[model samples]
Target: MLRKHLLYLTSDHLFAYLWQAGSLTPGPVFGADAAGLRAFALWLADGDTAPACLLADLVEEEFQRQLMPHVGGHAGRQMRRRRLHQLYRDTPYRHASVQGRASGGRRDDRVLFCALTSPAIVNPWVAAIERQGVPLEGIYSASLLSGALIRKLALAQPHLLLVTQQAGGLRESYFEAGQLKFSRLLQTAGHDGMAAGIAGETERTRQFLASIRLLERGDLLHTVILAPAAELDALRPL
Candidate 1:
């Protein structure tokens, strides 16, 4: 059995050892859920080191320390709950940086990584984690993360990735699969119903894919939506 449990961190929440149906390691992370934020690296703290629950309490006093008005608000209080046993989902899509670290029985299969969030949060957190010497292999946003998870489930390599935006227009691109495939961040009506949101996102993704064909189109790889279908109709199969 694995002796050391994994830690999954993100902007909103933190979870230790994320999985999907006992399948793969390096599972997807939900940017909106505070519980999915794995802000700290597992190696940063030894297996026995306990997180300071006081940190949550300390946050309320931070505004005063900054010489700003004290908001007297509790921020990041629930991350340190030692007794939360239901933190992990029952899936094999676990995420980790250290290659051999996540090795359960198969020492050959590589772990996948997906990070979905704005640069403001993802960038700084990534740097912070790296500075602290947290090990990792890949990183992507929630939308891409979700998509990547789907691809893993399908046992296919993703060719394209899509991200949703509330406003500020749309953006898209690709990372590992050369320049042919890409990822996109676009403004869609998240608050709007489902069909509209899915249609908008799907349209944007299609445009980007079609445009990429101008340069050189091989075959469509993969497209994913950050929001679940229940929240908003997901843009899949693009």
Candidate 2:
């Protein structure tokens, strides 16, 4: 059976990644984002060939996460927005922000409330996709995708960091109690030694986690590395 297409959008293009159940099909088209947009428009022109569920990753969106005491109902949402507003007060994209939450624990009092803003990047995409026949089921940040991998692996470490290479760079997402606490994307250079470059970034990420108190001094930070097997092998000895 054919799988639903997962679209991951960058500044100039969208990728249609085939995903069925929990697995993927290779050779995801690089131009699928633009193609999908056109197809969606055509589908709207008629009434056929519209996807019921579409998953998207907005790569250019910026993430700002804050911790807040657990509160319920509309008041909680308001407080979260207020905090988000304050956080982005100086940012140019303040008005074009999206918010989400990653719960720490069932009874945990603290929750990580996240805001992603990139009006220049997100607004156009939203405007393009809205009012179309497609459901446009969910929009997500690329960093958050690592959380799904952690869950799939059933990792139980309290302070774990997941490192994956994407778009010619290394993306790190730190998780605590299955919730994404922090993330960073580092650009790559000089691909002559890919392994060493990745290793350096990995160390930098570890220090960053410590500097931010996400990984405290004397804390054991379990790292989950995702890269080519050869690259991973070289990193293993570091």
TM agreement with the true structure for every prediction: 0.34, 0.70
- Give the alpha carbon lDDT tens digit for every residue of 1-238 in model 2: 4455455665445555556777765533443366656664554456433343333344344554544656778877687667766766543433222234444554424444444555554454454556664556566667666777888889879888887766535677788777777776666552336666766777887887788777877888787877776576677776
Candidate 2 local Cα displacement, residue 65, angstroms: 5.0
RMSD of model 1 against the true structure: 17.9
Best candidate according to TM-score: 2
Clashing residue pairs found in predicted model 2: 14-33
The TM-score that candidate 1 achieves is 0.34
